[model samples]
Target: MTTSKTEGKQCNLVNHDEIWKVHINMELESAKSWPQKWGFLTESYNQAMQESSKVTDRILKLELPEHLRTRPPTPPEEYLETTQAFIGWRSAVPGLQLERYGRVQCGKKSFLKELGWALDGCS
Candidate 1:
């Protein structure tokens, strides 16, 4: 009887795991379909800014020759245009905003909910 009960519990656990996986996949699909609505763009931009900062630090550390340093590399104008488009989108949307320290900001409840979503069951 005990052995059968143990097997039953194991089966239940397996079913629970499968259900969690399905739920997580659905959440991911929804987020992917509307990434900006889910704050993915803000998070991505914050990460990119951090990476850009790291690259800038590395470049500053490098001791390049005078001629090499004379003309810094420039990004294509399209990059600026894309950034401007994002800025316009952000102004029109009411969603996640970045704090001065790169942290995401929204209402307390919304921020907590987002934090919970990000944690995804992790302690």
Candidate 2:
């Protein structure tokens, strides 16, 4: 009958609309993860660059007088232990660790004050 055929077409149209909405939602969710994924990738790239710079620094340091070099070349036997220690010793804030290692005591810890100073680093 004509009424039955019309009803079937309307049901198909409704299903297609639902399918479109689901597809859109999936795409939107995937888009949401993109920024977080890029952030992780950026952090990874920064760490890699830092490691490369450390190697470059060591190479440049080879040109300096041997006594002035801060890092001594690693001996083979302790390599794994040293690497593990170095890898585990780091936190999100590396500058703080370096400051502590140098015994440079920051008198008072104020997050806002330090953030201001960090922002002013270009100047």
The all-Cα superposition gives candidate 1 an RMSD in Å to the true structure of 27.3
For candidate 1, the lDDT comes to: 0.66
Model 2: CA > 4 A from native = 1-11, 42-123
**Local distance difference test scores for all models:** 0.66, 0.68
Q: Write the per-residue lDDT of candidate 2 for residues 32-119, one digit (tens) a residue.
A: 9998777688888999999999999889766765333345557878664465565455432454354556666767876657677664
TM-score of model number 1 = 0.25
lDDT of model 1 at position 85 = 66
Q: Write down the TM-score of every candidate.
A: 0.25, 0.25
TM-score of model number 2: 0.25
